[model samples]
Target: MSRTVAWTPEATETFDIIVELIETKWGFASAQKFVRTANQTILTLASHPEMFVTVKGQTIRRAFITKQTSLFYEITEQQIILLYFWDNRQEPIL
Candidate 1:
């Protein structure tokens, strides 16, 4: 069965910021492409939530939507919560 996927407020904000930057730096077409790919990945995750690798000790998982972008999420009995949309190029904060 397919699970439900929802984004946390922070993840939504990250997505908006990234999309806007992509639109400005590249074009609407590029931004649209990114959105489409990301959405499809989310939808796909619903049915195959364990398809991605775990980030570490946490139950949270990381799915690479693109070479530079990743979708961080956690799954529960209730729903799949998207934690963040991360830019992998940047060094992770400790």
Candidate 2:
């Protein structure tokens, strides 16, 4: 069964920041493209919560939206909880 996907406040905030950075660095078209890709990835996660490999020794799974950006989430019984978006070049917080 497909599970629901819920975003944490941190996830929402990070997503906005990522879009803004993309828009500033690239353009509106690029930002829109990224948004579409992120939404599609989330939809895929809804049906396949474990599609991405989990963080070593942790329950959090990371899905790559782009080479530079990734979505982190945790799978629960009824849903996938989005934690935050990480810039892959930066040292991972988790």
Candidate 3:
């Protein structure tokens, strides 16, 4: 069964910043495409939450790269939580 998804305040802020930056650097279409791909990744994770391996015994999920950014998330029985939107050039937080 599909699980519910939720974004923490930090996650929401991170996503907004990424979208704004993408729009400023590229264009609305590019930002829109990024958002669409990110959403699809979340849905895919929710449907098959087990696809991600645990990190420090926590379910830390990483999205396949599209362009320069990567989407990271965490999943639990009650919630599929977005952890961060990371730029692939930089090291992951955790």
lDDT of 3 by residue, 7-32 (tens): 88877887898899989999999999
For model 3, what is the C-alpha lDDT against the true structure? Answer: 0.79
- Go through the candidates in order and give the C-alpha RMSD of each one to the true structure: 1.1, 0.6, 1.9
Tell me each candidate's TM-score: 0.94, 0.97, 0.83
Between candidates 1 and 2, the one scoring higher on lDDT is 2
Q: Give me candidate 1's TM-score against the actual structure.
A: 0.94
What is the number of backbone collisions in each predicted candidate, taken in the order shown? 0, 0, 0
Best by TM-score: 2
Which candidate wins on lDDT? 2
Q: Score residue 61 of candidate 3 by CA lDDT.
A: 66
Instruction: Compute the lDDT of residue 85 as modeled in candidate 3.
Output: 78
Candidate 1 lDDT by residue in tens digits, 1-93? 788888899999999988898899999999999999999999999999989988767798999999989999999986889988988888964
